[model samples]
Target: MNEGNTALTWHVDLSDQKLPRLLLRLAIPSVIGLSINALQQALNAIFVGSLGAQAIAAVSMTMPIIILLGAIGEGIGVGTASFISRHLGAGDEAEASRGASTALALAAPAGLIMTVALLAILRWVFIALGASPTILPIAIDYATILLPGSTLMLLTIVSGFIVRAEGSTRFSMWTMLIAFILNAALDPIFIFLLGLGVRGAALATMLSQIAAISFYTGYFIKRTGTVLVSISQVSLRVDLIRQLALIGAPATTTSILAALAGMFLYGATARFGDDFIAAVGIAVRILTIGALPITGFCIGSQAVLGFGWGARDFARVVKVAKLMVSITVSLSVVYSAAVVAFARPLVKLFSDSDNVTEIAVLSCIVFHLFFGFYGIQSFVTTMLQSLGRARLSAVVSFARQGYLFIPAVLLFPGISGFSGVLASQAVAELGAGMIALFVMLRQFAELRQGARDP
Candidate 1:
């Protein structure tokens, strides 16, 4: 079949299917893929853990930069996916293909710029973030190695998102799984056999990204769907770029804010000691793992929502959003309970130090208390983006991670010290989730009323 027909065929289920069933089809594979990817992170931490607390702390210090880069890729991905799905829904295959191509075009130069900027500021950045002399050198070394691989990283991230947009969720899922597995296999060899230490971890991650990029490049070459990632097709269309920026800038800012939030938390914890920083790092990784299912569900659901909105099937959009909320809430409950039950063991998995283990355990349990309601915000942000309500979605997204969380991290600790830090996240989540609930409900109401009108 032609690419346009292929795109339409892929979307048939999205428009005609039941919401719960569709979500299941999308979420199950995505969750599995994301879960494995989370596992790769945890294992990377584990590999670094064998070196020492300082190594762990060093990696922790650099996480904001790492996440910041990821944020850029994810933002672009969200923008690209939104545009592609919406265009595809409107039966505009050529435009959808062009958007995907433009995203890839944008990734290379952005990655190059990020690589240079990060390299120049590595030492200065980490130092400002409160890295001690002991951790500074290691942080620099690890970050220097990782920064050069930014292009591969961006390619992998954007490609995966675009593939998911094409209703090739399975392809996206397996791509991540393959990369996760590849990273896992390489970690030991590079870290131990070659004695690269923290640098090895960076190399393994970079190599894994290259593997993912290769898979995606192959996907485009075969032309299995409407979305084509081709250099020749990448046009400098000001309108498409503007649309993408409108939708993507907020998403990017949200991630950037998250990076800043990490810096804020890391800086705040610095007052206590490296043990605290290391503990927080471990706790954050665990939280990422815990949050993966919801993340995957939101990702999968966003594509579906975008398709519905593009088709002007507002009823389906609202129905799917409602079903997603129900599902996310259920997942949150399960995840929160698991964290509570496994808090000690999970923290223990990372460290044997009494101070580090105790602090990590407390933080994990305390930070996750409001996690059961986090899906409210995730659903709202993704739903807004899908519906092309970028500004509102951006506001909601900002509130969840940066606006609320940043201030909370900075101010809360003064009230209770470390315990304050732990509690701050839950407080932010409570507030953000409430706001998201309000926004989502109001939007649905408006959409419903509009549908009812003649």
Candidate 2:
């Protein structure tokens, strides 16, 4: 068979695979990739933790801003993935290529603009993010290297999503693995041997991201994938951009809201002391690491659901969603139990301070009590995006971190003190999970009806 036929066969084979096997095939690599990424973050924290509480706090302060920068790329990536997968499912490779190309073309400028704009106001931004005076300089040192290199990060993220949408998840996994391994190796060398401290950690991350984007560049350049993204195919077509934006806006808003919520949480925690800030930081990192499997599965399922929806195979979509929800919720429960069971030991891994350890332990247990709620929220959000229900997705996204979380974080701490701060996320997750369940049930009904209709 010709190469064209081979490509078509590959795409068709993805849709033909058994549901359980297909999801596992896709999700396992993503889980491994994301887990490694999370492990790297944990390692970064440990490396910085040795610098003292102030160093940890400084690095933590940079997180919100870094997340804000990441939001752009993630939004674009999600938009590109959804657009490409659906088009490919419909057997329009040209459209898929065009959409992918347009997204890639847009990523660089977006990253560049953010880098310049953010660097200009770095100090003020950190101050607004509640960085204490002592932590401000270290935060600046870290972000300076990171912000400028974010363009590479954007390219790497968008490219990974593009390949994953094409069911080339192993390639996506390799990219992440390469970056993580490199970052892990460099962390000690840069941070300690080189005495760069927080700045060294930032440098390692930037270099690793650079390597990742290089791999992506070579993959696309070699045209090793079915969707060939090239500058020649790039288009500034208004409709395509609008379509991307429609899907992307909600994802971007979701991330931006999380960043804003982080800022608010940091500010509230700061009122207690730098130790509290450090404790919250460690708890956040641990929770993030723990959530990787659920998130990885949700991400993997996106390609499957998008393809099914595009093919008008409502049964497949429904089955995938059901299976995804079951697995993710179960994983959340197990992870939450494990974390609660060993919260103190986990907290001690990052710090030796009795005060920091105690606060982090409490934060871990409180933050994860309703984590199964997060599983529900995450899957539902991914389901909506995959099905092209942009408006609904946007609403659900805002409800969690925006409407619900912002209020809880703002008011709860005042009502209950530090304990209230710890409780805010759990409360928000519960509320959001209920909202997500309602929406998801409605979705299931619609999908079932669609399946029966013609």
Candidate 3:
């Protein structure tokens, strides 16, 4: 399976490849692409930071909302990808194509409805999310432009997942790279040269999304890809949608819960001050950037895992799981140590305010204390999702941010003040990592037994 040969080969026999070699081939491009995307996000904050801490805070406030809406597309994408990979593994290309078309069908209307619904209550939602009086107007300004254009963003996300489902990660990587490059180039021009401020940032992101989706559209239309999707092939049948929903709903819920958790964290931090909000926001971006490789690895492993599970290649699945978990854990430890050591310099990149820098450095250190454990939680969750174990996946996914982190954030602050707030996520990571490890061990045992039985 020469992955470099991208001339109209739609499906690759993922199970035929060596596990380590294949995983690296798929994951490297994704890591580079996602890392660049994360860097662009950090750069967006740096560009916006010139306006003031309040401006940075305003942008930070909108993240939860953006994530909440984006989760819809992500859900569709995950479900679609899972379906496509499994069908392809079973040597059913038609089913894979149907899954792709159905995903697009679902994403289009969902994006539109989300835009309309969110626009109606934009002000109130931000306010409830802990935007102060001064930050409220700025937050609204940013969200207004970003929210309405979310349809483009949604389309790009789903399309990227669809491309990757067929083991075309290079295409997925190119789309993301194009978007990141375009967004990075456009950010300063729009934010400063065009004098659009935060709204300009929003515009730049939308334009980049337009570029990404355009590539995807061309890929599908020309039938130059693994899955051939056309207008005539699109289906809205009840069973098909339900099949997608069953796998997708849990993934969507996981993200939505994280978004809600962000809102809750914002509310808790708000009482401390806008500086706290700004600091926390910066730390969040830093964490996101740091975790990109781990995310990329998990995402890259998905196609392989899905195909193995679908084909009942239990031994292959087990091998992939062990290798993935070990590599991700090692990467996380290295990144976390580096971040903790260089927290000050990284925080200073986004803000010059001594107060903001000080708070942000602290936040980064505490948030990443148990960060290595996150690799465990993330890989297991991805494995479960790839295996279509939605119920268990959701439980593991929710633990890090939802049930565990929420209570820790709410109660810890009262117990130990601001430091407690920073520690909440670390505690949650440790607990969730344990949960994931327990599940992984049991899952591997079951797979081993299955392999012997048949």
Candidate 4:
């Protein structure tokens, strides 16, 4: 590697570092990164929220699916980062570069295929997701802009993770910061001032993503010593595909499950009224704002655990896992409190209807009941993935987003009403958190025992 490449590293050797200090170093930057990205999306909702419930609902209706979009991209990113980080930890620099190359080579085409497929399924999917005719056009506009942009978006995600794997997260942080600022600055002009409404909002967001992808791509050019694998090297290398799919597919699939869960929830809420579905949509965005810290902690754990495992430090893995749990729990409490204290106003910030406000208030409270579990679930799933236990992560993901969530949304709402639907996610989140806690505890015990035995 070139001297410049080595100098760019944060050199986070998890085994040699103290957990609290290391986690803070990683989590603070990651949290900021997560916040900026989340803020970009939130700006869309915030702007639409001012347009009225129909406008908000039009956007909210697509949020779940949009998350699915991100998940596919993120799955690829995670797969690449995990492999690269391990190779780097073992001091195999050439292998690391090759892995990074494979990731980029694989992601672009995969993204193209995903986009084409999304295009074919767009109309039917929206209709199936309980989007009314009025909302269908809006969904198409937003989704279409996202289609061609998927490759860029996916590239940015994978590139960011790769750029930071050796530990200098500044570029990742900077890219997101710029993207969010651009997104924020443009939201008002394109969405409000331009008289474009929802389409404008979607376009503005896509442009911001273009900026992110450009910045990320530039880093690999003559700077990282070698670019993230050559596009020409793209192939169905079984080992490379296997490693990426093993870790990436579950996370990606779980995001799909969340989308499915939303459909189920929306169908159930439809029984109450269109306004109710709109209310839940706003409630979710509000909830996501508080989950940022939870996500940050989980990202840190993945990095910490992955780096620790790379160095073959079983004790360090355990320490990092514990650190994730502790940080996740503490942040969960703080976030939950803030959400509860300002639930009404927070909802109001995105929306302006009295009926929507009332429903948002009740649902927001129900959301808060399970809010404290968010970070715990993230910690469990991410740590397992970091340890290369993809199947465990998959099962845990299924339990939380699919099995538990779908049932609760369906059965509960059938027996009661919209109230039951609101309560369902809480039950699922709480159940997932408990299961994650148990599984992680067992893993920690295993790691500690290995340390003692050796």
Candidate 5:
């Protein structure tokens, strides 16, 4: 079949195929792609760690800002994808194309705005996040290089969404894979070979993201018939923007809240010392390597759910949700166990300092013990997004990162000190998981009843 026919066939299969087969077909490439990206980040930390605790802490400090920017991009991407998939499910190719085009058109401006905003508030944000004086300058330097490249990062995510909306998971995966491979090759060369230190890591990352954006732009141009992005089709339609924000706002909040939680965690940890900051930073990056694949699966399955729900195929929605939740939770268990078992070795990869190693190892084990709960929450939120239940998704998403976590981090630390800080995450995860489970069951039950009645 030609590319256009292939894209249409994929949309048909999303609604027609068995849930297990469809989920795997869509989810696997995304999982691999996200996993490689996470690995590249870990490697970056490992390389940058050699410079000292200040460098590591600086990198850690910048994470929340980076995440907030990413939240915006991915939020738009997810909302755009949801809109497109729903249209495709209803066999409205023209509407789907319009969403694809509008999302692409918005990417650059959105990115540019984020760049300027982050740059203007760089110092204040870091200070509020509890960066030490020694780490502040280093953090500023890194952000300077990275903020301008926000345009590329945002567009890359938007492009991924467009491709995946057309059921081109492999194409999306390859875009990330190729970029990550290039990043992996460039990190050491920039950081050590050129002696650029922290700035080198930022430069390497920014360059890699630009490459990803170029690849995505080329893909769309080459496959124009499959994934259209025309200037004429772009519009500031109030309804379209509202629909995007309805889902995208809460989705973005989920990540922004997560970033806020991280900032809070960093501030709390900084009280102990800079080494602690560095240690927690290393542990979080390591944890990401495992957590991202589960998220990738959730993200990948969004298309499947959107198609089913838009087609009013409630049975398919339920089946896909069940399989995805089960698979992700199981994977989280295995991943958590492995990380805990090799915590010391993993920490060592990033640092040789005994103090940093001890803290990172303990943080690694404590933070991941409740991995199953985190995975459950992620699965439910993604399903909610797919069902276009943004409010409920927002509620569940808030619980994991902001609602429960903020209170737990504040109160628990006073009660138990350092251990309390570590345990607070597990507590939040458990609470959020229960709430997500309740909401998901309720939603799915209603969906099934509706299907039976009609």
Candidate 6:
């Protein structure tokens, strides 16, 4: 590693071999890193579950709002990743740094605004999400403490994107290493030993995010890299922000819709009690775990395709996108079976209460009925984003998270309550996956022909 070129280091030699081999090289590490994150969050939820149902329910309600704001981080980081990856592919280092600088400049304000608005919305956010009065106090306390720190989280995310796009996965991985370990270690101590209750949980999370901030910030400043997006590089201009947001906004908003949809699901299932809510929360975390492979492949393809698009390597982009969809869908069969086979033990990992366990186990199977299809959807949407096919990707994004999922949540609960709510997610995924598959196939064909899409 060249000490002076830390930022430029990611602009490495990409092998021109078979696409599957290349995708695997990227996907394996991404899977490990994403799994590590999932494990960290699961640990917190597991430990908190031991404290009782309200504690679990409190965390559950707080998650939607936290994740809602987390959209900025995902969106901005992705923008950075998209721009930097392409710049690297084009063999342009200086522009990549400027994009990196601009990303941070933009991320800072988004984080700041989220911090303040969440402060005022803390009480109402939960209430709006159908949180009952009994649990509202604890939920508010947790959200209030953790919400303000969303800014640091956004910075940390974009920083990782910049570094990773520069072909510095090791550095990006190491940063997560430090933050995840710190967060995991402090979680048990703060929640149990310090007896901080919900506040303890928030404190642990806050400290971890702040540490991530320091680790990433120090990496750029102290690293001998030319990624110095200085005061001059920072901009609040409409063009830069617009470009970044165009790519990121859809991904971010997709996550926001998921959070918002959770609220509707909550309303539908509330009659069953907090146990159901807590069970659903646990189910989500577990489901997300299984989807990691799909997520990783999507991200990996984004890099490959985004770069290909930037360089007018249309053939490579087409091959990569088609291969990614095929490989991901094939892998999903294995993932779904594994989950269904071990659903019982997986549910027990989160809660011992028979009622919670029962609901969780059942929810796990039902929620993932169309599990394989999620891979198809992830592959298509990520490919579109990487290729800067924003219009197509945005459609993929909105169909699954906003249009299909949200409406299902509202309509299903009215007809069938718990069953309806659970079924709605599977329906949305199934619908989106089918549509994305058709569109992705069509796009790949168009790319190969060097013809404009109709």
lDDT values, one for every candidate: 0.86, 0.89, 0.87, 0.76, 0.85, 0.78
**Candidate with the greatest lDDT versus the true structure:** 2
Q: What lDDT score goes with residue 223 in model 3?
A: 68
Residue lDDT tens for model 3, 192-262: 99999999998998888888999988878766677878777788788888878888888898889889889
- Clashes by residue pair, model 2: none
Clashing pairs in 1: none
Question: Candidate 2: deviation at residue 275, Å?
Answer: 0.2
Q: Model 4 shows how many backbone clashes?
A: 1
TM-score, prediction 5: 0.96
Q: Candidate 5 residues 195-275, lDDT tens each?
A: 888899999999999899898777766563354677777868989888877888788898899889999999888888899
TM-score, cand. 1: 0.96
- Collision pairs in model 3: 10-226
Whose TM-score is higher: candidate 1's or candidate 6's? 1
Locate the minimum summed-lDDT window of 10 residues in model 5: 6-15
Stretches of candidate 4 off by over 4 Å are 1-16, 225-228, 232-236
Off by over 4 Å in 2: 1-12
What is the lDDT ranking, best to worst? 2, 3, 1, 5, 6, 4
Candidate 1 C-alpha lDDT tens digits along 260-302: 9899989989889989999999989988887887888988887
Model 2 per-residue lDDT tens digits across residues 1-454: 4645544433324586599999988888889989988998899999999999999999988888888888999999998999988987898999999999999999999999999999999999888877888888999999998888999988888998898899888778888999999999999999999998999999999999999999888878867678989999998999999999899889999889989999999988998989999999999999899788788999899999999989999989999999999999899889989999999999988998898999899999998888877788889988898888899998777887899989999999999999889888988878888999899999999999999999
Model 5 ranges off by over 4 Å: 1-12
Q: Which stretches in model 3 have alpha-carbon errors above 4 Å?
A: 1-12
lDDT of 4 by residue, 1-454 (tens): 6656554463455444667887777777778998877677677888877877767776777776666666777787777667766766666767667777787777788778877888888888778777776667877887777667777887887887776665656567778899999888888898779988888888888898899988866667645533245655455678878898898888888888987887787777766766787889877777777777578667755666777787788887887777678778888878888878888888887777899989988888888887787777788888877777888998787777798989888799878878789889889989988888788778888899988886
* CA lDDT for candidate 5: 0.85
